[model samples]
Target: MDAGTELEDHFRRVYAGNVEAILAYAVRRVEQPEDAADVVAEVFLVAWRRSRELPPDDEVRLWLYGVARRVLANHHRGGVRRERLGERLRQRLTAVTGGDPAGEVPERLAVRAALARLPQPDREVLMLTAWEGLQPREVAEVLGVSSAVVRTRLSRARARLRELAGDELTEPGHVLDVMTVPAPEEGR
Candidate 1:
């Protein structure tokens, strides 16, 4: 086979083998599934470009992990990142979920508000453990912290998130009002 054909074949096999794991990792890490998809796509794109020099089996998975981590970090780097990713995430989410993100809107708003109230580090800890499904040890690897520290932070962060959720959404007026459409007049 020609170099081009060989590379394509190799990449296809690698991609099929690892796509599910990579996708799961991304989805767990990101608040928006669309962002997870972008991360996965970027990881594979990098893999494709560097296909000729890739490592063996699980090494490829590890390399994709590293790439995904970097991609997520870059995606959250600054204010501009939010605006850019927000628009794309909204579009993609709407498309996939049938333009009726309405169902989860209140929950998302409440959680987002709660997360916004948290310190960045605390938020990251909570997100890694709860949203990303990372164990403390895995979280430490992702965050460059000790596992014990991750455990400590995760405890405090979870408690704080609980507190925030209670404080923000338990009141009668906290949610659902906006979702209720007004009835038409009986007689005008």
Candidate 2:
């Protein structure tokens, strides 16, 4: 294939394959679900612009992961971040305004609140394992750490989360699993 065709083909395959994975990564790191959408867009935009640098086959997913992690870091540094999430949240908010609230269960909210209290590093480790369903080695790839380091971090994160959650919320293997549950929809 010519360079243009080659890049097009690479973009299609990588975009389709890694979109959800990248989105999940962004959501785990970001404060809002809509920020996850901007993350997804920016990631793909970089891939499109730098298609020549993309790796072959499934490795492109890893490349996207690296890009997303940097994008999130840049955003945290107050560098050139956009409000893709703001627009989506506005739409979702408008749809639910002046309507009955659909509540997140009290327990789930508590768990989430406790999670939010954890240090960002600890939270990311827990989320990479629990929410993203990544193995320690795979997580190592995403976070640029050794597998042993990821495991150590995951263990510490889990303990911190459970401690923050307190005994009433304690349920082995399920403490951080609240991230797995979907929230209730409003005005649907």
Q: Against the true structure, whose TM-score is highest?
A: 1
Worst lDDT run of 10 residues, candidate 2, spans 179-188
Model 2, span 18-124: residue lDDT tens: 78889889999988788789878988989898888888875788878899988888777653334655666676666644354344366677778888998887788
Measured against the true structure, the TM-scores of the candidates, in listed sequence, are 0.42, 0.41
Q: What is the lDDT of residue 44 in candidate 2?
A: 90
Candidate 1's TM-score: 0.42
User: Which candidate number has the best lDDT?
Assistant: 2
Q: After superposing candidate 2, which stretches have Cα over 4 Å from the reference?
A: 1-104, 182-188
Query: How many clashing pairs in candidate 2?
Result: 0
Clashing pairs in 1: none
**Residue 17 in candidate 2, Cα distance off native in Å:** 45
